[model samples]
Target chain A: MKRVRMRRLKVEKRTNPSAWTVFCISLVSILLAFVVIGFIFLGFGINPLEAYLEIIIETVGNSYGLSQIVWQSIPLLLCGVGLLLAFKTSFWNIGAEGQLLMGATAATWVALFSPLPEPFLIPAAFILGFAGGAVWGLLSTSLRSRFGINEVITTLMMNYIASNIVLYLIHGPWKGETMRGFAYTDQFPESVWLPTIGMSDIHWPTLLLGLFAAVCVFFILNRTRLGYEVKVVGQSPKAARYAGISYFKTIFYVMVISGGLAGLAGAGEVLGVHHMLRHSDQVSLGYGYTAIIVAWLARGNPLIVILTSLLFGAIYVAGDVLQLSFNLPFQIVNVFTGLILFFLISSDTLLKHKLSFRKGE
Target chain B: MKKAVLFALCLVFLLTGAIGLQAQDKLKVGFIYVGPIGDMGWTHAHEVARRIVEDTFPWVETVYQESVPEAKVEGVIDRMVRRERCAVVFTTSFGFWEGTVAAAKKYPDTIFAHCSGFMRAPNLATYMADFYQIYYLNGLMAGALTKSNKVGYVGAFPIPEVKRHINAFTMGVREVNPKAEVHVRWIEAWFDPAKAKEATNSLIDAGCDVFAFTEDSDTVVQVAAENRMPVFGHYSPMYNSAPDYVVSGQLVHWENFYLDFLSKVHAGYYTSKNLENVDYWDLLKEGSVEVGAKFGMPVNPKWKSRLGKTYDLVMERIAQMSDFQMVFDPFTGPIYSRKGAVVVPVGVRANYGHLLSLEYAVKGVVGSWPGEPK
Candidate 1:
């Protein structure tokens, strides 16, 4: 056999970029995204700067707008932080939307039908919501562990089933008598309603719970033995096996935690915002899907998920503001968010990989 | 580089402030929609009326947000009332009923007119065009044109408003062609274009030669036109989309209602004491709901003379009712459900309350409610 050596340019993985460098890269990428969206605004005969200014002013400047930002953030924060846990362990739980729906369904049932005392009702509803979501999450996780079915497909499919179940319930047995044949349930009693802070829409308990969950998840991922195991399993399953960590146990735990958090969001939304179960589309507005982007943007850091979720929430608030203020189409917000996510991913890739050129030998 | 970015951010803030100060003192009016204005259906009709309101009253400023979900309607209403200082806000969807009511309670000074909804508060009033009248007119045309004796209807949901329209349309169909049947397919969405198109194809396959829909899209009309089937548009005039197929449709002229309501406010008739009872349920007689004659009801040209006669009869009856010379109620006497049960006995007009929550499919209509077996 003739000896032959092939040589080509080799890609190399660089050391993790410094925090400051990463921050700067993110900032620049976001600015670039805005610039791109500004060009799109120009295409529509809108002054890009004026349009951008209107969004910022309407969504973040006034107190009501600020409260709306917070109200919108609660769901994203809960879902995004929960997703961080699952993504960290490489569980690929894409059924957060379905799980969230199940949670909302459970919470609504408790609020509407449960005979628990006023004090117990809210707490009990929250627990049941979490359990409903956890059970839904466990379905896909168990399927993946036992039958080796892909979690992504199962989770995504479950979303449709979950949404249909809600539709069926609203359209059938649980339909409110006074709704006049509309697809909505009766409002949750004021007893079960999450108390708002002052006259604002901010539900303090859920907001505090969301903040606490972020901190708790941050500790769990950084300072716990389970976190170590998750790191090992996510980095390499073979290494997890070598370290005597159970992949099945870790995956199950991560998904339950992830799904429980998302469920909490559903409960908060039902209790705090909607005060009733409506059509499934009206319930979540694709919060689960948006959280996926938030999780990716935060890079699995639970603490960062809070900031990123708030950013995404602001995007939503700003989207509505832009629509009302500038008469810009809703699709503009989608484009803006898409560009930001695209740039963020590209920057992350650029941070991790270094290019090299070598002569052929 | 960081300093430059900071400077740009500060500039953005300053520019926003500068623009924010350019607010006008006009009487601000806000509209909230459950679907996009480009839907060419329910929301589009309302947008057209919004434009008319803007054009008619130079002292009024109109702003609107489209495709707002029911869950977020409260916030949108709050913003419209608080941030935008809208004196009168119109929420143009049934799903927005509760939210509008809640906001009406919170902002007792701001007047709210909720369209296609039944709920009302002290500051909140309800307004809706009597769409069933036009549906009946369209059904008459469908009855004459449907060679297959099978007319298709794509319903959004099994809500009372839609059920009433279906019942009225069926009544018209049976009056003209007793043998004709109306087959209904519920798509469970208000504005899904693809699903509407699919429903149209399925109805065509099921031997329906004429079609009508309550969905918020032009897809059904487009599909019907493409397949050479006659159809009716929902909210706005959709003849431009399906010129060949469109016979006639329910044209909801909200401008008349809006002008009347706003004029009441302008004339100091909208005081808090009287606002609670201000429900404007207008029909063809009030010019709020019209047959699509203005859009040039082509009537298939083949069925023109026959459908034209029926149309003239409907118009004459409407005129008589408007002039208070006649009491011709569409839901009067001899109404029967599909199950062969008498819904409205002879010489008896159906109660308005009963009509509001009509749940059963009337005779000659071929579909059940959401949970019932098809």
Candidate 2:
């Protein structure tokens, strides 16, 4: 009898993958995710290809859809940029959502309660927004620094606190007088309304600010001494200690910038999107949590986050389109987003490893 | 890859042309819902109404986007108007006020109807199928059957709508048994099962045997029934959830308004420019709401005898409220607040303005009341 010959499979580390290869791999990864999602669409009796085509036409093919997608990205970009920085320092700041809510809260104060004149309202709102977000971020940092509490749990828990805070405000003191028994704050006066691009909801001010943040963070992560320290601390806390890099200061900066940026996103929601402080769910739509996927997909590159955020914006719009056209359930969107995240995460493994086939011994 | 991309583009073009051809001359109507249509309460009723109009009117084409976030309502409206070419849009949710108004201004030629909201534009109108009257009728039954004489009320929010219902229910309870108290608990949400369960359990623990609620789900009814307590269901029918436990509920018939409104739209009566004052604040008289354990079952037969002497009163109240002349209202004159403030003076029927902004607890209510008079 002929001995059964088996072909051996081996896994080896790919030291470095070029940009082109990684791009191709990522593209394939996205397509694979869509292919999987398409099957789910089939389960719902929808033609996957037609649904995909409809989404493309609605979002990129139509001007209004394009603007809405672009508008959706502003919050994600702001939150994602902040998250990538915190992740780089390995601080795992998971409370960008809370920070964003706090920022919106601060913006609401300036817009509604402050005595600031019209000319100063927007600027004052943004400043207070940033400060509000940073303060919320620092609370968790102090706990981690002083008491050695795990930041992941603290950050996640604080998100609930932030949302509840928004809930309490909108339900209580901030409930609009003319809203006639609804749970939301009064609309901001026109003086503080962020200027948009034409008839679209795209607030150029927030979009430009988010881009500027991305660029500045890119530069900081690539060129600065603090960038090097952040990498080392993230890569090895022991090495950071040996090299005399201050973990406290590095984490402090990451938390501040991350939280502050998320706050700015929150303020943008009020100033640019809703023009009022609303329920936290309405204000964010899970942008803070979704931005984690955005940052993760960017693979530590701040500039890459622009594309990732836009991709997420399109995904969200596609979800809306599905609901509009197909009458699918809300969980369909979660499943779609989850499948993409799962596939993208798996693709990250392929970027680091190569598979080989060996002949039988 | 390039060829595949080209093929995809062609498919998109063909699909676009196909959709354009199918659009034809139908009056496209769009609905924006803040919750899923299957929620079995507000949005479900709206969805049912949408289907009715779609089926009944040959010239109407309906589409909807459910679970829309209030912040994203504007975007959904844009897509509805621009992409779907919706001539008439109905946004159902109080939180959608600003978005509906903005969309009304953005699309002047488009007709917009908003539900349960105050702010309206020339192109946007507001409508609501209030059940305070039905709630009062249910309260009458609750007042009669409560063994503990402590009626538990699981309120969704302290908003005026819920407050009005609770007040009306309390009025009915007090009218029947003046010594009985209405214990209230607020869950601070329109629909939250866990919180609803917790609130119901807490109420049960406090020895309130009879129950009524303003939540979007049957959680309160189910919870109360679990403890062998009789309950009045909130929005939608709950006899199926716990048939023996649920006595009666306030049900909304949104299709009455939808059919009337859409027919008017189709007949060119409701144009884009004339909706500013066209509010459809329909109630029992208009048949927009009902008092029942389920549709066509005003009272559970099991509880009919249990109500005994109070069944006649419930029937009478329903008949009076359902009359076009409207002989009686739950919020009649000489009603006093729990703190002795005059809610309604003698012989003064609570008008639309007063009922829409009511924020007081009646004499028999026991709980924290936000926005109550000081």
**Which numbered prediction scores highest in lDDT against the true structure?**
2
Q: For each candidate, what's the DockQ?
A: 0.56, 0.70
Candidate 2: stretches off by over 4 Å: A1-8, B1-11
DockQ of 1: 0.56
lDDT of 1 by residue, A128-147 (tens): 99999999999998999899
Query: What is every candidate's alpha-carbon RMSD to the true fold?
Result: 4.5, 1.7
Clashing pairs in 1: none
Model 2 steric clash total: 0
Proportion of native contacts kept per candidate: 0.69, 0.67
